[model samples]
Target: MKSLLTAITTTVLLSACAHHDDVRPGNDNQHYVVIKSVDRSEGIKEALGQATHYCEQSQSNMVVLNETIDYKGELPEHDYLKTRATAEFVTEAGSWLWIIGDGHVDDVAAVAAVAGAGKLHSMGAPYFVTVNFRCT
Candidate 1:
């Protein structure tokens, strides 16, 4: 019983930490893109945001094509936590957005790291959410 409780606690802590994978473009489809989220809601949120950005860039509209959520058991060791930087540089967001820090990219995550509040992911969230969307 003790061992079972320990395992459950470990799982809970791990799931509490959510990370975003880089935006992936769909193969053979120029308008399609994939947003991967370690957590489901966050990933779907990213997909919508990405599609929105694409539409605004091309003066088009965003239409979500499909969404798939899957659990592939244990994922390989991934250091998804954002590493804060002692030094930083950020550009204004309007036509473009830029947030720079250690172990960071100038993407949606950067924005989240800088401005603070993003989604509130609780313990034991879904494993993964893969969102496929199109910018039309």
Candidate 2:
């Protein structure tokens, strides 16, 4: 019985880790951004700020139309907890703008390692922010 219990516990833990590995902020063909901080809330705050900056930079007359937030997981210490924010805007030229900000409390070292790999914009210790913008 004890061995069976151990096996079950191990399976659960492994599955949880796998789920964390699969966590991603945005989808392909859309702007992707990532922000990591000491806490989930702070990370989300930073991500949103970056997203707004991106939108503003795109066009001076851009107007934010809608925003949505999604919480991806539980537990901050394990780097599983994530907060994602999506905002839609309309530019002066009547083009649609889409921005996505993903925030999480993840390993600082790991986050830094991927800095500037592709769309990664910035990375500073506990906080990292990535932004993508599409206009049509």
Candidate 3:
């Protein structure tokens, strides 16, 4: 009985620390792009720039749908929890509208990355980026 209780407690704790899925489905015209880096702020900045470039190429206005930052390492030891901070980065939205709008690229992910990058800016931490977009 004691072991069973321990197992249940452990399971609960692990689940609590796990990362949540941040992805959301856009319209049928939506697309997604993703980027990851060890530098948080820089990663976001790069993502935003990429998004802007895509918008320029497609002549579409930039619209950010979502942004998130997540921890990339294992749960810290109890003693280290106070002193250790997990590396983090952001993922912006990704959408397909850019590619379809531009009529120059068939890569949906690539186009979405542009907007994702544009939506982000460097935080000087390790991170990732995801961009989503859709046309009205």
lDDT (Cα) of model 3:
0.48
Off by over 4 Å in 1: 1-30, 75-126
* Per-residue accuracy of model 2 over 73-107 as CA lDDT, tens digit each: 33342343221111011121112111222233233
Report lDDT (CA) for all predictions: 0.50, 0.39, 0.48
Worst 10 residues of 1 by lDDT: 82-91
Candidate 1, residue 108: the lDDT equals 65
lDDT of 3 by residue, 10-125 (tens): 99998754322333335664644455664456656655555555554557665666556554533333423332222111112234444444554435545555544543432223
Question: Can you give the TM-score per candidate against the true fold?
Answer: 0.38, 0.28, 0.38
Most lDDT-accurate candidate = 1
How far is 63's C-alpha from truth in model 1 (Å)?
Answer: 0.5
Worst 10 residues of 3 by lDDT: 83-92
Q: Flag regions of model 2 displaced more than 4 Å.
A: 1-29, 60-136
Using lDDT as the yardstick, the better of models 1 and 2 is 1
